[model samples]
Target: MHRLAIALLLIGGAGTAQAAGIRCDGGLVDRGDLQIEVLDACGEPDFRDDWAAGSLPAGVVAPDVTQWTYNFGRGNLLYILRFRNGRVIGIDNDGYGFDADNTSEDCGPTDIVPGMTKYRLLSACGSPAQRDSRVVLRSSRHFRYGVAEQIRRETWIYNFGSRRLLRKVILENGRVVRIDTDNRGFD
Candidate 1:
C-alpha cells in the first residue's frame, strides 16, 4: 500500500510537470526587450472556462496556456500564450513593477513596502497573478475567469539587511515562482 501511494505521488508529480507548458525545443523571440521562449510542453490551462474561446483548428489540441514571467528590477513582465496545433492563438503581457491600476505609470521604487506578501500587494493593487524572487523582485498573476475572479501570486525582494521589501514582481502560479527564484531569504 505504501509503495502504491508513492507510485501515485510520483505519477501525479510527473503529470504536473508535463502540464507546465514548457517546451524547450521552441524558438525564442524578443518582444520589445523581453526574450520569450514558447515551450512545446505547453501544459494544460489552469482551469477550463466557457468564456475562453475554443476557436482552434479542428482536431488540433490546444496546448494549455504557457506563461513566462520576467522581473527586471524596475519592471515585471509576463507572457501567456495559448497554442493550438503548435500555433499561438492567444497572447497577453502584464508589465510588472508598474502600478497595475494605472497604465501611465511605469513601476517605480516606492512599490515595495516591508511586510508585504504577494497577496497583500495584490489586494492593494491588483492584476498580478504570479510571482518569484531575483536580484530585483519578480512575480506573475493570471485570471482565467474575470477581473473580479483574478488569481494573484507574487514575489518581492525581501532585504534582510534593510528589513524591508523592494523590487517586487508577480507571476501567475505556483510553478513559475519555483522556476524564477534565485536567492530566497530566510525570513
Candidate 2:
C-alpha cells in the first residue's frame, strides 16, 4: 500500500508541472486561453509565426498551430509557445536560438539590444558587410472565432563580415531581436 501511494504522488507531481502553462510577466498563459487573452497577458512578443500543423479533408476547416517567440534579450534563452484553435497547446525550446557562439563587440563601450532601431544598428556597425531583407505573411485562424487579422511582416539580417566572430544580427519591424555568429558563413 505504501508503494502505491508513493507512485500516485510522483504521477501527480508530473501532471502539476505540465499543467503549469507558459509563464510570462509574473502570470501564467494557461491552456484554453484565446489568442487575444494570451496577447493581453503576455503583451507583444519579440516575434510571432504561424504555421499549419495538419489539414483536414477538402471543404473542411483545418486547425491553425501558431508559434510565438519571446526573447528576453542577450543573456536569456528564447522561448517558443505553440498554440492551436486560439489556445496555447504546448511550449518547448527544441531550438537553442542563443547559438553557442561566444562572439562579442564593444560597439563603443555599449551593446546593441532588442528594441534598438535599424538606424542605430547601421550607425554602430557602419553598415553590414552583407545584408538580406525579406517579407513574410503572418496569417492564422487561431484568432478569435469571428475575427481575422492577416498581416505581413518584414525581417532584415545584417552580417558584419563572416570572420568577425560577432556575425549576424536579425531585425524585425525596424527593431533588433537577435545577434549571433554566422554559422552558415557570410553569403
Candidate 3:
C-alpha cells in the first residue's frame, strides 16, 4: 500500500509539470514543435508579434521570441503560443474570442484596461488607429554578471470617431501597463 501511494504521488507530480497542448484541426501542437509545424497544424494565426528576451551579457546574444495568437470564435478561448528560436516554448490562454470578421463591433475603447494582454485588447477593441513602439534597455546588477534586458514598449492610440474620447494605451512587453484619455476623436 505504501509503494502504491508513493507511485501515484510521483505520477501526479509529473503530470503537473508537463506543458499544456492545444488541438488544431485534429492535430496536436505541443511544446518543442517547430514554428512551421504549428503553422501547418493551426493555419495562420489571427495576430502575431515578435520581441526579444534573455540576459544580454558581453558578446552574448539574446533569443528572439515570437508570439502568435489564435482566435477560435466567441465560444472558445483564445490561445497564445510563444516560440523561441523557431520552437514552441509555451502556450497560454487569454480571454474569450470573438468572430474574426465581426471583431470591430464587439467592444470599444472603454473596454481596454491595464493588465490585459495584447491579444485580449485586440479582441475587445479591434486594431488601434496609430501605433508606435521602441525598445528600452535596463541593466540588472542582481545577476552574477552585468546584464542588460530589452523591454518592448508600445504606445497605441484609438480614435472612436467624433463622439467618444481618444484613448492612449501604453504597453510594456506586450502587456498593457497604463491608459490615458486624450481629446475627442475625429472621423
**Evaluated with TM-score, which candidate comes out highest?**
3
Model 2 misplaced regions, further than 4 Å: 1-19, 52-61, 94-187
Candidate with the greatest lDDT versus the true structure:
3
Tens-digit lDDT string for candidate 3 (1-187): 0000000111122112223777777378888999989887888887899986544445666678898887777666667788889999977666555676665565677688888889778767878999988766666775357567667889999998899899999998788989999999999
What C-alpha lDDT do the candidate models reach, one value each?
Answer: 0.31, 0.49, 0.74
Off by over 4 Å in 3: 1-19, 52-60, 138-144, 161-165
Alpha-carbon error at 5 in model 2, in Å?
A: 34
Clashing pairs in 2: none
lDDT-better candidate, 1 vs 3:
3
Model 2: per-residue Cα lDDT over 1-187, one tens digit each: 0000000111122211222455556356665777788777667755566555233334445455576665444444344566778788865432123322333343521356665545345445455556665433344576455343322233444443444454566775345766665454443
Listed per candidate, the RMSD to the true structure in angstroms reads 18.4, 13.3, 8.6
**Best-to-worst ranking by lDDT:** 3, 2, 1
lDDT of 3 at 95: 52
Deviation in Å, model 1, residue 127 alpha carbon: 20
lDDT of 2: 0.49
